[model samples]
Target: MSLSVEEVRRRVAADWNGIVDVLDEKIALRSVSAEGIAGENMERSARFVADTLRKVGVDARVEQATGADGKPGAWEVIGEKIVDPDAPTVLLYAHHDVQPVPDPAEWNTDPFVGTVVGDRLFGRGSCDDGAGIAIHYGALEALGDDLGVNVKVFIEGEEEMGSPSFIPFIEAHRGEFKADVIVVADSGNWAPDIPSLTTSLRGNATCDVHVRVLGHAVHSGQYGGPILDANTVAAMLISSMYDREGNLAVPGLEGCEPIGGLERDVDELGLRADTGVVDSYELAGTGSLASRLWTKPSMTVIGFDATPVKDSFNVIAPECTFRLSVRVSPVQAPHAALEAIQVFCEEHAPFGAEVKVTMLEEGMGWAMDPDCAATKDAETAMAEAFGTAPVNMGQGGSIPFIPELQRIFPDAEVLVTGPEDPQSNAHSPNESVSVSGLEKDVVAEALLLDKLAHKPEPTNL
Candidate 1:
């Protein structure tokens, strides 16, 4: 039976109030990553979500998983059985983990205490991901027993730490967690009031570059001019990564196919305002905003450690180290990218200085094949919800678990969408969500489930 749009909207409206209460209670507790709350508090957060699932007639369990470092890394709460066991299942993914609250003085309210001002919910995890959890629960509750397809909810506690333990956990229980579709709710819409499906994510690789120009530090006044300064050499090497046009000059970096149908004028204005770049400064070498940000590989010098800027600076620094982060194309191999970066740093070092490069972390990117049946269903549902076809977008940031999820379920259609907007302020102070945005997302998710449950599976790409 087809559910009436009005019926679904009503269900979502009723559930939205309850979801806000649940989110408030969950956010009131401090679940800062690996800190603030450990042991019992960590268990408490897991239990809270699990129990909520159970109360809504879903079979839920909390499972412990060991980390790569051999620590009790994370716990996952699984909610199961939205439809017949043998039917195709969809995996709904979200994270309960959150970053630590910075200085209390920086926040408008206690970071752990949920506060509501106007339509916005204020809290540390309010927009980053706690809202994601709430949305999943709301969609499931709104659908209730009427849901036609099987759905499984997997909420993890280690997403804030790059989800190191999740891949292992998924590997260990692949049989029990098989799915036809994976709905990753951890991402946001490209802009407010616009629904977007993230089709590509840029892979990430981090490395530290160390340059030693001399055997020992010397007085700058004595050895300044003729001596090779390690800091200057490091600066030169870093600057070489980008050309005068701010285009990445790394060899073998591939560009993405441009996405049409986007308002280029609006995107450029938004990018400039968001990035705070000077109006006169041309926005880099770009074919399209989506192509430059999503398809093209980029490099950033995240941090540099050397002699302190304070105190006496008369001495010539003997050594300098810089932390570099590279965003690779979805098709690019992270290890290969790391090797290329290492070679570049070694070959480009100035003045024949000794340069050592060490990789810190590497992860592959993920891209969804938009030709899949689930993709069509999701797009249809989103169009129904928002009155227009959803934009196929790409994310510049990497979600650590996406590639792993793809590897674990190669045949499954993965879809990434959520209530988050560009102005959501995720992972920063004063993060918030629009009530209407949440409403639209809940409706979209419910409609997606309905559409997926009834649609015929695609026979060919």
Candidate 2:
């Protein structure tokens, strides 16, 4: 029985209101995984996902996965419906956890409320992973129990906090998570109108470096230029990470060239970032700005501790601390890149200052070779749903869990996609997702599942 794309699209359209209702429930839960935040929301969010799945006819369960520290981590929702033992299995993956709302006052709507205005739904997690859940749910509902392929739903709860327990969780449940294909709904597209298949993702690592120049604070008038200030030493260490052109100077962490010539309009990118590059200043790194962002490793000082300027008395600070946020190329191992960073800091410590570097967390990057039958079918499904050809793009951000999934399911074909556009502003104030985009992805995923059911089982290549 050939399933027409129009039929699936119609089913998705009919289920639009129900999908949004589910999304609203997900957004309402403040499922943040940051330190000091209540774990109730994360637990509730996972339960909500399992309940949503079970309500829709899939047998679901909420299980807790321990973090790297061997303590209780986020709740994981795993659901499965075996329609036919002989049929292919496809796993739908997403995260229920969300980033913390930096400031609720800065948002036009409450960050926890799913507010709809125009064609967009605004809330924390609205676009990032909330849309992922809704997409999977809507698609599964449209297909009902006879979804052609056997289906499994896995929604993680601590992705925003680096998925520290993901590997352990997968290892403990290896047999239950096997699949022919894994559709990860946690990436964004090139535009609202254009669908994109993310083919590469940058790796991520973080470290805290503390520099101390003196045992105690000294008066600036008495010490002055003779004394080496910790702030000056910290600045020197940071500066050494970049060369004259502001490219990462750390050795042994090489970057890969872009596989596809992906380019973005600087103006559109600037609009998305909410900041514009000055005409006088040259863009950093080598190659096109697209490659620099998507393929090259980049370093940023995400946090710094120093004396407040407002409370300034002329004083030479005793110490300074910096949180280094590093993005490595998809081709580079995160551990290798982290080692390079540590060595660079130690070698460049200025004025005999005491420098201590500590590794916080690291996640490997991934590059998907989209030559498989499953991925091709997904590309076609997305094209039909979006009314345009799908583009293969690279995402600069890290979905740390993806690499782990790939490692555990080595033979399974993986496709990364989401309903977010640049304007979604995920992880920022006023985060949102397009209503139309969600609908399109729902139809796309449903169609892909339908197509997979009819195709030959993927070979274990």
Candidate 3:
């Protein structure tokens, strides 16, 4: 059975109040899954998700697995709504864990309470994935019993911590996670009225480089003129990675030409204000702003080790270490990029300083088919809800698990979507989700489900 636009909108409007209330309740859970938080919070969050799924006729339960570290993984809410024994199954994925609030004082409203101010809801985890949970819940509520396909609701509890047990959990319960389509509602949108179907995600890797100039610290006035400090040598190493325009000068780390041709104006997007960059600061790399943000490679010094000002006594440092967080193209292998960085550091050793490289971590990038049957149906549904076609976009941030999921289920159509907009400051102070935008997301998803149920044939560009 096909549902009309008017029907979908009416149902969404009727159920919106409960949806917002559920999102608010989730935001207050404090289900942080960082390195050192208590484990009970994750369990509590899992229970909450399982209970919510049951309300919508899903056979849900809480499950957990052991990680590679030989410890318990975060609790995962796993369940299913099998409308028919022989129908296609769609998997709804979202994370209930949140990034820890760095400083509560930085927030205008309480970090855990979802407060509606004007058109936005302000709180931690308000948009990042809380809205995502609500969208999945709201769609099921709107569609009631005529769901075209079966659904498996997998609400993870530790996505913010890199999904350490995700693969292992799948290994333990692979059959339940299988589906024809997977909707990952964890990325962002282009605007409140405009949707963004994320088609690409950059891969990520990190490394630490150690530079040793002197065996031990020495008086600056005595040896400073003849020798360079290790700190200064480390600075030289960082500069060597970029050219005059600040584009990456390293070879062997590949970057692809821009895809989708989606141009972005930095000023209108509030890029400067979002980053709190200084006035007249020139942008790094060469290309359209969209290309730089999505398709190109970027490396930044995330951590530095050196003497502090309070401990400074005008001494030439003996050795120093700095960490580099690298973002590479979806098509490039992260290990290859990390190897290139290591080779560059060894070759460009400033002043012949002894160098050591330790590759920290790496995650593969991903690219999705924009012309698939499910993608076309999603575009049609989102257009009907928002009165405009969704833009095909790419996110620089890496999800890591998407690649693994695709590898396990090669034929499944993976669609990345979310309610976050440019103003949704996820992982920062004053994070929020636009109320109107979230409602649109619910309607769009409900409509997409209706289309997928009826149009099961494959379509391509």
Top candidate by TM-score: 3
Ranking 2 against 3 by TM-score, winner: 3
lDDT of 3 by residue, 1-461 (tens): 69999999999999889999989999999888884323888888888888888888889999876788878778999999998878778999999999999899999999899999999999999998999999999999999887878999889888988888888888778899999999999987889888878888999999999999998899999999789999999999999889999899999988875555564433523777778788878777787776777878899899999999898898899999999999989889899999999999999998899999999999998888877888888888888988888876888889999988998888999999998998888988989999998999999999988887886457786
Query: Order of all candidates by lDDT, from best down to worst?
Result: 3, 2, 1
Candidate that scores best on lDDT = 3
Write model 1 residue lDDT over 307-334, tens digit each, in one string: 7767647788899899989988887888
Q: List lDDT for all candidates, in order.
A: 0.80, 0.85, 0.88
For candidate 3, list the clashing residue pairs, or say none: none
Candidate 3 residue 159 Cα shift, in angstroms, is: 1.2
Clashing pairs in 2: none
Predicted candidate 2 versus true structure: per-residue lDDT over 294-367, tens digit per residue: 78999889999998889978889989999998888999998899888888788778877888899988888998
Candidate 1 runs further than 4 Å off: 36-38, 219-223, 258-266, 278-282, 457-461
Model 3 CA deviation exceeding 4 Å by range: 35-38, 263-269, 456-461
